[model samples]
Target: MYDFQKTQLEFIEHIKDPDNKPFKHPVESRRMDIYRDLFFNNIKGFLSSGFPVLESLYNEEQWNSLARQFFATHDCRSPYFTDISKEFVEYLSNEYELQAHDPIFMKELAHYEWMELAVSIRKQTQKWDASKTVSNVQMSQLASVVSYQFPVHQISQDYQPTEPSEAIYLVIHRDSDDKVDFTLITAMTAHLLLTIENNEQLSIDSLNTMMIESLPQLDAEQVIQGIKQIVEQMIAQEILVPYSISE
Candidate 1:
């Protein structure tokens, strides 16, 4: 290995985790400390902003510990600063070891928060004509349907629940005006959205029929009316866009 390359790797390792990976290279302690603080603080600041709710649930020391763990261990793949939050979410979902102090809903809450940021910055590839009454409907690129065991949307420092509740469903979407918001939805609505999202060229009428068949206990007319209402509401919120058959 090249001398300079080895030195560079050692420097990064020390900066990422000073406590464990001590700097063995020829560098002044003051210089290394400055670099360590700069790098760690930058990462910590972004995490604090990205997961404000999660941060609030912990004390400053606890939050810093969590952030440092992510910095020291997770191998982030994205080069963009905006993607750090996503990397943190990935770490929580796949890599983080649950500490007893950690909330049970930590992973879900992190995901819920990240989705808001993700939807806000997501780029739109195609424009929709809201006036067009197209038969086929598809979920918008900027919209996401999520289900969690806890009511992630309602969780806060004062109201953290110890036990999981019934599965909660939510739809997060960005409107044409570029405002991001989420709506609490029923399990049935969640099912309908997922069905549309997974299928191509599925019309609302077809979905209504499928729902009626699946939920035979409900009156057919009532099911049709409920689906119609949900479809209209979703269209108005830009969660469901009119899909053009030509495309």
Candidate 2:
């Protein structure tokens, strides 16, 4: 009598360990190897496509080694191919560490590279009118609006420069076309976006007031223009969609 749960666990354990006792027959052994190869290859392909810049940054040997390590260690939650990249990015952020003297921009660069594909595959069936919503709709912002405190744009994956420069703030968002777009934002702009996303109720004027106080160096007129420009850009990108209209 074959116990399904026990058999699956045993198979998993066997696949993970090279020195483990071999499974039953020639057929079983070959089948298990196929599964193991497919699993690793699938994950590697997904991650490589998602982080092309990172892939190019590292040599083939280094990239493959990192992929193998991630494959062995990360406990992926999704069986879907699309979700694998998300998990890989999370792993890179939480677990993977480059050299101590390695460019601080590396992490952000990996993330920036991943965003293009992430947004490209994102499901965005919900339709919202930009002009209408910005005028009268009540909306909730997304938590995924991340800003990295790194000058990632200046870093070239092809030409690894060796110097530390001032950090740049980045804003990554999925556009209306479902494409991911990245922009450099000021600290105040990043904060304003976070506040709106968190509170979901700050009027444009209120946001400007907060910006004025936060970025005193920027005059109110400049701040207003900047805010308008950002809002327009977000709308164009489809990051900001209409929520609900109030009577």
Candidate 3:
């Protein structure tokens, strides 16, 4: 019985790291190679899909080294395929380190790429009225309001930032067409979206009123007009979906 668990763990560890694996099972090396390739390829696919931009930034050899290290060292516990990307992010945070030539913002870039897929698959947690007017609104789960130290939205092969600059804010979401959209916004706009997101207990109208009251220095009518335009735009872009009770 003890040998059963020991062999199981040995097989798993060896499959994850075939090159320097300590355990030599009684099985033939050919069969073991098949097992190793199958499992590693499955994980590699998820890693690539979750961080496409990061993968593209590296040449094949560099990318393979990183992926191999993660596959061997990271103990992923998620049972869902979709959760693999989440595990990849956690692995990056805890277990992975950048090479000498790797970008300083590699982890942040990977995280930014993973977020789009995360938002795409997120289930809407609340029922919203599709027919309701945009004057009052609630943000959908599809939208993710995030702030970064660097402009992650503009990152590419050419636009790497060497130093942290001003705070960069963005709202990312999947539209009705199932296309992911990134909207660069001001800090103030990010706050407005966040307010709608966190204050689930209150309706949008009540929340807006509360927010405007808190900012007493601003003209009340002007603030309302600004918020109105933002909400309307979000609805038009399908970033925010409206809903109503069947009354």
Candidate 4:
């Protein structure tokens, strides 16, 4: 009798290889072809939705070529269909780069575009504190939050007319409603968020003082207001979970 597991593995290998001898279906060869086509088309459709902008950027030939390459190279770990996009994005980050003069902005553009789906699927585990004091609070030590080096916020695949003269900054987080929100943030704001994540004990006033010195363009009032706005939004969206209130 055939070892079911080994037989299944052999069948999978056969299906993946166009050169391999076809599996003898009890029914007919045409049925096997139909199955093969269905498998390939389903994966293609899933990838297309995951990387819409990337698909639009490249011609059909180029897009298919990349997809084939991705399929062959990456050993996806997730069994769930929804996680495939995350795996594809991870592949791009590790293995792909824009061709010479192709578009310096391509990498960031892909990242910015991918964030929509990434944030939508992200599972948040930490609880945030709403009443925590902001003044003099240490702002550098939160792990749940993510920060990126690229100025990805400026390029809009849909709206922007001309390329930007300067780099952009962005922050992406899941709100309370389970919706992903992307916001353009300043270097100081980014730094402040990082500080909060890093330091166990921080004061709100000290954070403000640091922001004023770190970002010379913004005055104290503007910085304070900006922080307040972000905090409120974060709280409402559930990005900032309630931890503990200070006395």
User: Which one wins on lDDT?
Assistant: 1
Sort by TM-score, best first: 1, 3, 2, 4
Full candidate order by lDDT, most accurate first: 1, 3, 2, 4
Residue 40's lDDT within candidate 4 is 59
What TM-score, computed on C-alpha atoms, does each candidate reach?
0.93, 0.73, 0.90, 0.66
Cα lDDT of model 4 by residue, 1-247, tens digit: 4677766766665455434445553547777678666765667788899767657767777776677666656778999888877778787778876564234555555666677777777665554554545343332111134344444554445643235454455667666566666767665556667766665555556656666777788777998787778655545544444444353
Q: Pairs clashing in candidate 1?
A: none
The list of candidate 2 runs beyond 4 A from truth reads: 1-7, 17-32, 97-105, 124-144, 154-156, 162-164, 215-222, 236-247
lDDT scores for all predictions?
0.91, 0.64, 0.80, 0.61
Candidate 3: tens digits of C-alpha lDDT, residues 1-247: 9999999988888888878876666798778778888988888898898888888788988888788888888877978889888888888888887678788788877788889989888776656666655435667778888888888878888788989879988888987667888899887788888887776544667856977987799998878888888888887876776665342
lDDT of 2 by residue, 1-247 (tens): 4687777766665554434544543456667779778776777887788877677777787777778777767888888778777778788889887765345567777776766666565565445653544642112222145555555555565566555555556666665444556667666656666766655545677767777887898788998888778776655555555443342
Cα lDDT for residue 209, model 3? 90
